[model samples]
Target: MTQTTQTDRTTTGAIPVPARTGVHELDPAEAQSAREVALRLVATAGAVVDDEKWISAAAAAWQELPLSLRHAVRAFRRHSGSRGTLLLRGLPVAVDELPATPGHGSSVQRRATVPAALIMAVASGLGDPIAFAPEKSGAMVQDVVPVAGREEFQGNAGSVRLSYHNENAFHPHRPDYVLLICLRPDHDRIAGTSTACVREVLPLLSPAGREALHAAEFTTAAPPSFGAGGERAGAHAVLTGPASDPDLRVDLAATRPLTARAERALSELADVFETVGRTEVLTTGDLVIVDNRVAVHGRSRFTPRYDGSDRWLQRTFVAADLRRSRSHRADDGHVLI
Candidate 1:
């Protein structure tokens, strides 16, 4: 892994910033073991990825995975480490068996597949998988692929550089963990997923900046991904919890500062994030998990051919404690209204 203390100005805009890369690769034997579990899951009867019964089966299959994989995921659930990100390489994705990257917008994986099985199993290890009704039609497994006519859009369908943000930052019941699995890379393999953790940015913040960010002086609106008609978050602190290690809750593209000092603080926070952020170019079978409570994530710009070979990634959101959001979910279902 690489580290830089110098501040980077390019990241203040949409340009990609130089970043440290770290990954935990599974051995051939371990990867094969995971593949076996995924194959069995694919063969299960009524293997719909989003159905409550299927989700329960996936959760049960979690215990059948390799011991190493289960241990690593459980440990991450307890503590996300200093970077608040974990990249697991060599998962059981059968690239040759996959279909063409979805060309339409709001693509989701409803049928069971090897990649879906792997992602859902991991989601069960972290927590129960959850989804918002307004986002991606409340699908448990959504496709993060570029779509035609949405190149400049800010959501998953766009190929442009996405700004740093906690997934669903405007929602009171935001995901505690965001899981993304790579099924295919972009034509150029240059598109990188980046993350910046508050643990690293906290130490670099000025006393005044920290004070301002801790106050309830920021408001965040819903992103384009959620469409329209959602309520915006009221005045809230960008950083919360203990000062030594605070949780981050602001989207650079949607969060607005309410006061002059708050504005300066927000700018300073962005700069510090740029200074410490890291980007990783994920490959097939790679799974990156972001601790949403402690870090903000984004993507670097990439040109999508719009052909059948565009980059393809599958995403799932996890709630560490599902019971906390019971009121928002109707009939104790996974989809939150």
Candidate 2:
């Protein structure tokens, strides 16, 4: 299909993606095997490698999978999301062994070892090829981190924080999709993944609340993960209504309202999250995809063991095709925009 730029894309039903085939869940056995290999690689390394290195390794590992199973996953990737969301039953997450995050002295790109190729495949399989562009000098997750956040956070095997949020509300162009590959979960931790669809909650808003959200500006900042020095972040309208494809921008941690009307909209938005979002506890070897355009995602608060195998999930982002925002992408084929 020719690239869709500035086109009307909203419908009454869950905003659908013609490219999205259908939801396909992974098999437990397949997920476990990937976890096993990842754990061993991490155990050998002793520290987290960089995202690029791990991505390269994962692509290789996935390419090496048995033909039948490999073919199945390749098929699954195509039909996963509606322009955005796709869920993989497993993605090799384990609590016993995981790569360590490289400290300041070393390159994180070398430490981010991944066990399964599903993540690489999913991003590439669904929207576009995975962009290993490090957001910061040496960042981990990809998609240019088009948006950044600065919340002090950690996820235990079980304990985790899944606060509902849009990945990069501060940016001018947000991603069409958000992909997560699970490597481990705190067995004793109960942190859950939280997600909310704007479509699901739009009906609950009062007319005035809706209008306030449609206004053109509100403050938003990077999540603590990228350490956006609170001030470096900027503001954006919480929502901009269009006849089709209404643009929604939000971040629980950084978004600030300028007027009481905006505040009311924010409150209504919060209520929608509480009353209309989806919550699922991500387990070891699972992969979760979010429609960055249709839904916001976060983790429920949980404690981390800080042990070698605390709940660790490898994250990556994908923009539909970099064609629309070529100017901002890193030369390395990754979207820095």
Candidate 3:
């Protein structure tokens, strides 16, 4: 673990850089316990992860995971510390046993694989897992692999430097937690998943910048992953809730400032994010959970060989309060329309 912090710009006054957190590494025994739990889930869930019965089974299996793992996740759900990110290393992912990374767009794991079971079980512990109808066919577990022709795109299929964004920022019922489990690293191991929390960034912003961000002067359009006819958020504040510890809601790629002051504020916010953000190069069996309400996440640029073994990470979204989006979900299911 390295300690890296950026100095605040002289023009913007002094910005305090928070201490970096260490990865929570599971011992061999704990890892094995998790593996058994996930394997049992695979047996019970059968071959369909999207089935409501599978989700119910996963929720039951969540209690069977290692007590340490469950405790960590429960504490994070209560308060996500200064970084608003939790990285757990040494889960139960069998890298060598996995099939070739999918190269197609909108890839999702509908089958009840080991990795899929592990993520879904954890998702149930944190909250109910949810997905957008327009994104990745509304599957709970989605593949975060690079697609052949979408190298320059901003979404999951791209290998470029993805700008920081709150996942599904334009949606009224956006996810509260975003979980990514790394099954394979890039060939060069340079693709870093970075996160910046508003807690760490608020001090770096100017008074005027903070005020402008709090005002309803921004609109966010749905990302390319949503395709055509996706809904957009209108006239929303980039920062909401208590000014002391406000929630962040801005997508660097999709949010647009409405006024001149708002534009300058957005730029300032971006600068602060770059200054205080932390990047982690994930390895196999590593899981990173970002508090979507407090932090925005993105990825660093990495070259994809397009071979069978490119970077492969599976993702799932969790909504802390599933009832809030009941109307958007059909038949009270998880997928939000």
Candidate 4:
């Protein structure tokens, strides 16, 4: 892993991509082991996906296990967690064959790939998982990669200039983890996903700045992408919750700090974001899990080629538990109907 430190203003906004070493790469055995564990956890999550009652029962049974098992269970979850992002190359890909159109209505569908079961399994391995899709949550993991019928590259969505961000940063229901499972790469394969650890940047701020970060000196709002159009919102406190286990609230475009100290901490936060964020390209069968609380994630720009096989990735949101967003979901672990 590469260590990160703050530099003068001249170096801000640039996160260097480090050369890969042997340890960060996963081999077949480790990949398979991860898959099997995810399968077990998903089967154990008590979810009614695909009308499979046994899987639901399986998930429930695992939940009954000893508490000590949780940590070990996550071993099968994310291997390198200090950075809060783990990369695995081989989990089963649901749509092994090409689809009639990227948006076909089957397991072989193109734009949206990856089995929902696997996502649930990974969530159980983490803590709690749920869908933001309305059909599942009211929001589909909306294909930003491939538009199914069209061959355009949809890596992150829209024409907006995307920067590092904590997804759903303001909402009380933000997921603790964001998993991106890749099925196809853009024609060029040059696009890279970027991420940075808050731990790395926390030390860059002045003592007073750090204090402001700990208090309710700031406010953030939903980005324009989530229908926040024409109107803007604000957030108080750059963060809330425990220091050890915290929930971050920030928006690069919308975040506002009340004092100079709070402003400095926010600046330090952005500096750390660009300094430490390591960009990793996603290839076929590559699955990356991001710790939403500890790190912010986004991607670099890639032009789409409107061909049949554009970049395709399956995205799923896991909250770690439904209680975190009780105002948005109903019981039985399903989103509000």
RMSD of each: 10.6, 10.0, 9.9, 11.7
Model 2 per-residue lDDT tens digits across residues 121-174:
455544554332334443434211111121244211223354567876666556
Judging by TM-score, tell me the better candidate of 1 and 4.
1
lDDT of 2 at 185: 58
Prediction 3 global C-alpha lDDT: 0.92
Residue 42, model 2: lDDT of 50
Candidate with maximal lDDT: 3
CA lDDT of each prediction against the hidden true structure = 0.91, 0.55, 0.92, 0.57
Task: Estimate TM-scores for all models.
Answer: 0.93, 0.68, 0.93, 0.69
Query: Tens-digit lDDT track for model 4 on 86-161?
Result: 7755555544553422442122211222244454454556765555432322332334453334322222542123
What is model 1's C-alpha RMSD? 10.6
- Residues 1-337 of candidate 3 have per-residue lDDT tens digits of 1222233345355533422453577899999999998888888835589999999999999999887777788878888988999998999898779999989887899989989998999999999999998899999999999999889999999999999999999999999999999999999999999999999999999999999999999999999999976678989999999999999999999999999999999999999999999999999999999999999999999999998899999999999999999999999999999
lDDT of 2: 0.55
Per-residue error for 145 in candidate 3, Å, reads 0.5
Which is the winner by lDDT between candidate 1 and candidate 3?
3
The TM-score of predicted model 1 comes to: 0.93
Q: How many residue pairs in model 2 have overlapping backbones?
A: 45
Q: Using alpha carbons, what is the TM-score of model 3?
A: 0.93
